[model samples]
Target chain A: MRATNDTVSSRIEIARAELTPIQFATGLLFAAAIAFVLVFLQEPLAHDAMHNFRHAAGITCH
Target chain B: MIVDYLQRGILAGVVAGLAYGMYMAFVANPLSEYLHDTQHEHGHDEHGHDDHGHGHGHGEHVHEHAEHAVSETTTALVSIGSGALWAIFLGGLFALALYVLEPALPGPDGIKTYVLAGAGFISVSVTPWLVLPPAAPGAEQLYSIESRLAIYVALIALGAVVSAASIAAYRRTATRHPAIGVAAGAVPIAAMLAVVPSITPTVVTHPELSSALVSAYRALAVLSQAAIWVLLAGTFNWLQRRADPATAVDGSHETLTTKQ
Candidate 1:
């Protein structure tokens, strides 16, 4: 019983040690990915593309 | 797995979109309006001397046309929509990368995790500049080269600060105490709130006030944004703690086994 408890406790400690960093790192990566998408989405589509869509819909930038 | 990635990506997108939308509505839009109104009120009245000035006909006509086309609403909508789409796409990529790298990366010391996180943040913020279309010929450049350079520097700085704060907070919380980390994390949020008003110049109709206000506003805005980012970093760190697999027990098995 004592040996079993000791092994379990040691394993928990090891796991805790391992998981914390991974979680933090993963969080950072997630933040970065979100930032990238935001920047890309801001780019203006080509005038030709917008014009085509507008023509299809019977509208214009003017 | 794909569904999970999609869900996470969408969640990230929503969070980013909402945050950016609120900032624009509450902060940026008002500032833009103030600047526009002020510029109109104190604009160059002395330039009406077409009789004395050479080439006045063409110059005055061009200036008048430029002034008429300057609409704040149009710019705001474009900014908001662009922000939302970017967040979604970037969020998806981040989620996918995490899913792949989680297995191979060692997290025992926290350094590798922090580095990866910082890299992710920097890459997403700076990469879009490469593919962005050139500014329209007659349209004043939205992002000046100097401003773009500043943004790149700022993104890297912000990532480093957030990463450091997160790691420190996590380490503090892990050693059976949570107060220090919580307080440290909270500082960034508070700083953001306090700094925004200062950095954001009040739009006044007077030329003399505009320059000073703009300078102050810029400083405050940067500080406020940094604070918000730090707070976000802390919150993410806390979530990571809650999701830590070590502390969670498997209900299916009667015998407790430590699962990595």
Candidate 2:
């Protein structure tokens, strides 16, 4: 039982320890896109659609 | 792995967003409408005979009522639809942040999840709130929307900087002086507060709305946002554990036992 526990713990540690560079870059790009849509995009209809949420979330919106 | 993380985030966000929409419809919308109505009443009083007086005829009044009904339905639908979409976006961001920062953040996965959630709240909501607090519909505005948004974007970037600096500080100084690490982390925020004259420039429109009501609205907004972060973190952590057979919580798995 102890050996089994050790194996499981080690496996979990290995899994948790690493994040590849490609993964990091992908996350960064995805996050930036979401930020742009929420904060920067100014098309009239899209702006109006998200207006209430922008306000509710405390983002600066008219 | 990235796809799995993104999927979990979307699922969590949908759950939180539905709750957020309900909050906007039932709690926030009514409060804003009340404040808006009061503002118009004040306007009517000041003018002594305004557009509201023009709508007093019986036919016009019924037509106005119908218009208001339609508008209310539209508002509720918009709140739900947009709430879901925005929450999903935020959830994806939150997952990505966790993915990138997990290696640097100390502690076990569970603790790190909550710490990330707190950081998310600070970066996304609390930090910008220092300068641009959540305001009621009738607040006196000093800046245009463009200026406000520019400032907001800058403040959010600053928030991310502060979060990273604080984490780096703690990591570097933790063995020697932990308290000093905390103070160092706080230095940027303290300096900003000192330099900025009107940190919280929110002002309720006078003679129409009370400061207390505005405060309540801001408080509710913060609470709802906090709820989203909490939900995101909890859901993501649960999903991670479920996906990993080695860490499975269920007792049915013979190889992965909870008992020591």
Candidate 3:
């Protein structure tokens, strides 16, 4: 039982390591795309977003 | 084996992305636009509002609009383009996660898709929203952007962890006591939600107009996400079933892929 558990755990670890590239690419893809959205639309959208709050209090975000 | 998963993931991701993206283009975009129009007519400041709880995009992009003179078609196309990218990104990641856990997951293609998509919905939308409620055009912004973002990311991570653990726990306990397994499935999410405080309790942007608008906004947000998950799951299942019937692994072969 103990040996079996160790092997299973190791297999899972190996699988995770093997998947690192795919994981990394996916993360990078999402990060870039999201960044693009923010950068591209920030000008007008941010203005409308921040217009009404009193005191311009808290974090000033565009 | 990994290659097989990657192929399936990409294929399903693209198909589902297109479907979800189309829905956004036709259905979601117009809905948000209508809401914006209505809100403006209400005599409240005519600022833009976000669809699907994303406060950033819905606002007016005045400079770009003015400088570019972007027509409605161009705007719609841009929205579709970005929407497709988002769908692809999210769908691919979701597929990868599901494929990774495929070995341990039981059930047929249909069950598996529902579980994966539902858990995803919970992780991505439901859980995070508990902490950082959707921001509208004029909600009182009490928290700093940096702090709010940090906490929001943390909450999202926490939600993902809880969701994964819940799914795993359900899998384990399910074989022993089915009822216990069900309860176990819910325990982690309940605990997490209870422990986490709301990022901002909220201040009414417009006392009279705020309630109705916010309510509609939130409801639409939830509806949009629910539609995405449903469509994604269905589309992925259909593509998988079409590619190779034998490898249809989400649910059992007993049910039709499209039905589930």
Candidate 4:
């Protein structure tokens, strides 16, 4: 049987509520991975690599 | 599995950060260098620009350029790495904020990207700067460190709070009357501007550096931030389009009945 517009809309609503956390989690994972780049590749990047976030935030720690 | 939109957003952010960081490292002129060079020139001039190149041998100018600044190779390496990290931070920031505001965002990805990018710039950079203007390393602090930190944090906090409140209000009210939603947004914006006098600009006491140089440096700093947001919005949007980021239920029945 073909799904009505009402049926489809309700389904999307339920799916979205379920997916928000998942989407956010995926984004967070990606962010963590990016941070790992600096941590794992410490030998090549030098000191400035770690403080890049501070600079982006306009903080002058030094 | 439909493409992981959030993961792609993170990847996009990392790429944007690297792009900005590299721009900052190799391409973007370092404000500190300008300050250092100007200070050097001023000191040398005061003593007298001696005809002989050996004049710097004495005690007056002790800062050997080679000793203080890192080597070119080192600087570039550090710069690229840092750029990547910065991009990632920015990317993650937008991704989260956009996710929260996704319901309010319009469709078609094209128009939506502009709104997302513009909002990202405003919330992340503009609102904060209204209270805590961006500063270069050489700039003098007009206030105490604690005070500066407080204002910076407050401004950023205020920015986030206001945007979230305003968007939620707008969306909620728009159902009955779209104009009411537009009007509702103004309240949070007004609250954001409630205290402006408290924020004083940083002083640049370095006598040698010209105002133009200082202005240009700060502009570059702002530009660097703008670039990151642009990159994030452009790249992330492209990826999200490819992934077909799930649309949120905006609470508008008209919109609801029209699409799926």
Candidate 5:
């Protein structure tokens, strides 16, 4: 049990160190696209579609 | 894997979306409609329009009332539908944040999800609200829409940075000087809450309307937003566990991922 715990912690450290640039970029792109649609899109129809949810989430919609 | 993250995100989104829609339809919608009506009435009074006889016969007025009811139903349905879509998108964002931050986040797997979700709420909702409390319909706007949007976006970025820094600080000192980390995290948020509200004041456009109603709506807004974040985090963590039955048994996320 003691050895298993040590191995688990080390493995976690390895995973932490393994986050590559590609994965980081992919996550960033996905996040940015979603944020734009949900918060920053200003086209009238799109804006209207998201208006109530934006207001509920306190996103500065009129 | 990236696909796994997206799948988990979409699934979590679906759950949060439904809950958000239902909450809006049942709890928040009525208050919003009341505020809308109050604004309409206030506008009519200002314009000196007759309450019942503004260019419509009594029969026409009845017809109009029926039409308004129909439209209200449609509005409620549309709002709920759109709300679900919005929540789903937010869930996608939540998943992506988790993907990026999971390795670096402190605590065990389950606790990490909650921490990320709490940070998300602060980044996206709570911090923006410090500058601009969730406005009930008909609240007077002190800034142009563009200006308000700019400030909101800036505040969200600031909040995200502060949250990330706080997490990093906590992780660095958690075993040694945890109190320092806690203070480091709390002070910025406390300062923002105290200073921002005073700098950016919101005016009540219609004083005659019930203040209680506005307060109720704002309160509900806060609760609903918080609920969505919590649901998204819970659902995401549940899915992660389901994917790794070994972890489900041992509560260890590191074992399977490292092997992969």
Candidate 6:
């Protein structure tokens, strides 16, 4: 029983250590995805909107 | 796991993007302009129309303009695509380095590994931008938007890969070594500096500025890139630390347990 408990505890610890880095890595991956969406989609949307607004406003003085 | 990856990826990506974007805006863009001007001046001299120079100036200007357009188009394709491609490659390299280095250091839970990965990614991503003149001459302003975006994407991808790989590798090693991580991260910067001359044009002449200005600008470009990478690395380190089990115990533990 003691051996089993030790095995279980060690397994848990191992699992914990393994998952910690994975968790952080996952965070980074997710962050990258968000950045992609922002750069590819969100920024373009904002840019188009701003362009249209400026056109309508006749702000082409430049 | 998916959500966590997405979150961290996006965070690191945005931070990397901003850092890269600023470098592009202030340094790379200016350097490209200088290169373009010099190229045009040389072109004019090559034609040897000293007597009719004024008359041909306008024609030369138009030709320069066309050249600028072509350069811009090509640069857009190369800079964006190549930048992203290199970022992914560099990320893998950083991870591999960390994996090899992790066993030799002393620490707890691979904090060092994570730090090293972050630093390595930042250094590699920023170094090329600093050293390599804009891929295309003359159209810095035109291609800046597209090229910068591509580079940013690449930097973000690189950071994500490096961070993920290093962390994964470090976890497997029995002895936790943070120094290995730090050293791994620092190695790439040294490597980049060593190779800068080979990859980048040396002693470029500029029509707009004296030799001193060119040198000063080049130096500034390097400093700006280094500063940007340092900021990026610091941000990633802070994020990792915040997410580390030892630091933010309650919230991170809860998150970890729920995931388990």
Q: Model 2 over residues B1-260: C-alpha lDDT tens digits?
A: 43566688888888788777787777766665666566666554332222232232332211111113235446556656777676777888787666555656644567677777877787888877877787655444456567777888887887777777767766677667767766765676566556543645542233346778767778888998999888888887777777675654422124323322
The candidates score, on chain A by TM-score, as follows 0.40, 0.48, 0.45, 0.37, 0.45, 0.38
TM-score of model 1 vs. true structure: 0.40
Which tens-of-lDDT digit does each residue in B172-258 have in candidate 4?
A: 777888788778866777666665534545322333456776566667767878887778888876775554434322222333344
- For residues B1-260, what per-residue lDDT tens digits would candidate 3 score against the true structure? 34444565666667656765676567655654454345456733333242223233533221111112344455555556655555566677677676655445544557677777777777777765675565443344445556656765676687788888988888789898878887898898788777664444642243224577677766766765666677667776776678667656533222222212
Of the pair 3 and 5, which is ahead by TM-score? 5
Q: How do the residues B104-212 of candidate 1 rate in per-residue lDDT, one tens digit apiece?
A: 3323313333434444543333222122211111112233334544654654465445544654555556466556655665565345335543554331112234446
TM-score of 5: 0.76
Estimate, for each residue in B1-260, the C-alpha lDDT of model 5 and write its tens digit. 54577689989999999998887787666666766676666554332222232332323221111113235666667678877876898888787667666667766778878898889998998888877788765555556567777888898998898788778768766777768767766766777678877886662233445778667767888888899989999999899888886776554445434655
- Candidate 1 lDDT score relative to the true structure: 0.40
Greater DockQ among 4 and 5 belongs to 5
Q: Pick the candidate with the highest TM-score.
A: 5
Best by lDDT: 5
Top-down TM-score ranking: 5, 2, 3, 4, 1, 6
What local lDDT score does residue A61 receive in model 5, on the 0 to 100 scale? 54
B102: Cα error in model 3, Å: 2.2
Chain B, per-candidate TM-score: 0.44, 0.76, 0.71, 0.66, 0.83, 0.42
Over 4 Å off, model 3: A1-62, B38-75, B106-109, B194-200, B203-210, B249-260
Worst 10 residues of 5 chain B by lDDT: B58-67
RMSD of 6: 12.3
Q: Ten consecutive residues with minimal summed lDDT in candidate 1 chain B?
A: B131-140
Candidate 6 per-residue lDDT, tens place, A1-62, comes to 22213232443453455567877678579769866854563343333322211111111110
Kindly give the stretch of ten consecutive residues in candidate 4 chain A with the minimal lDDT sum.
A1-10
